[model samples]
Target: MKLIISYKLDSIENVIPEKQIEIIKLFSYSKSDFIVRKIIEACNLKHPNLEKIPAYNILKNNLNEIINNCLDSIAEKRLVNNQFDMAIIEVVIIDNGHTLIMKLKDNGIGLGENYLHKLSYPEFKHTKSQEHFKKKEKDYCIGGCGIGLFHLNAKLAKNDAKLYLKSRKEAGATIEISMKKPY
Candidate 1:
């Protein structure tokens, strides 16, 4: 149950260095206490941030959503895989002067086709129902409301950010977010 997190940030000149360091440090310190309860072997994070701006708050909130998505992926894997081993999560942050691009990729059982379809629209409700939970009492049930992606999409939209998700059954999934940089 070990989850390794690794990240890369390109072109630091585009972001506020102090904010970037603070955010990464926060993640490194609190990752061990994540609700997923997984061991982390090696984790590296890099990103740029805006200093003393509402943009930082917006991005910070969005980052929390990103973490939720990662946790959801882990929960899905635990439910489907017989023997869930280690998982590696790779995050990339790119600063293009005007925008910040973030991509999160993970090695786990990918999304089901039906699930992926549900994610295409923000209004779609796709969580596993309580009835399904009742049947899964003896099975692995991580208790997800299935609103992670929907909420993520909404968050991105509020910040004029764009999101792209690519998932294949049994293969892993990747989530990419692009947003204008905060001044």
Candidate 2:
């Protein structure tokens, strides 16, 4: 797949540049160490001191959703098309002493045209999966109940997080979450 992942480091005003880079680098390193490391390394280009923060679990969940739900869906689609179309994932972070914000942008097929509206409702649910995804990878499986985002959002909300999602059919999607730092 023609996938490119990039980081917007300049927008992080409150965090020191070195620390911002460190955090971003940590995120990239996580991608490399993901379950599908080879596929990630093949399709993507070669890409934190917060060892024991309370938000670590939350961050891990977010990473899981980003990979299993977001990027995996894109990869599955590519398998069906038998070609790699262009896709981009951009991560932007803003950290101040009081609050932290992370935004992700992806050019992969978005959460469908009406997903955002449905997501606004408390009872929203949907699953987009393909059989090819299961057959292509031994370590991965296809099928989801579509509750990952809901659970993640709920957890974030309980932590006083603010989330914004903008998505479209062909235009891709942007997800931004802002929350307080637990330090």
Candidate 3:
């Protein structure tokens, strides 16, 4: 029942088109802020205050949504005793000046085939199941609204970015976001 999060930020010169970067997964939820701060620093924004920057806010909010989704998926899988002792979330950020690519992988219960298909739509829909609602009360469900991904995609679209998601039931999920640098 431990959460291990890790991330790697590749330098612009070191980045290869399809090169696979290795990330050593270690750390906990409490250290997530440090990881994020490292990513912001890697962006090399000239602004004195990151919070006041639009791109910074967008990136931070998107990351938070993805991380929360991973946590929720892990929690649900844990309820069914389908998850391992350690839940890992590995993030890779590749910034090459023009483009910013973020890849987040999680060891958690993944989206079902039906649910994944539904995600293609542009409307609001509940991604959770009735069993989920019954087990975790509606008020207690952390991400029951199921609009996080929708909003994430909309925000990305506004910034001329794209989102790609891949998942296998009971295995895990990978969310990749490719956006232009500096929003």
List TM-score per model, in order.
0.62, 0.57, 0.66
Model 1 stretches astray by more than 4 angstroms: 1-56, 120-122, 127-134, 143-145
Per-candidate local distance difference test? 0.57, 0.55, 0.63
- Looking at candidate 2, the ten consecutive residues that score lowest on lDDT are 42-51
True-structure RMSD for candidate 3? 9.9
RMSD of each: 10.6, 11.2, 9.9
Give the winner by TM-score: 3
Clashing pairs in 1: none
Backbone clash count for every predicted candidate, in the order shown: 0, 0, 0
Off by over 4 Å in 2: 1-56, 77-83, 127-145
Sort by lDDT, best first: 3, 1, 2
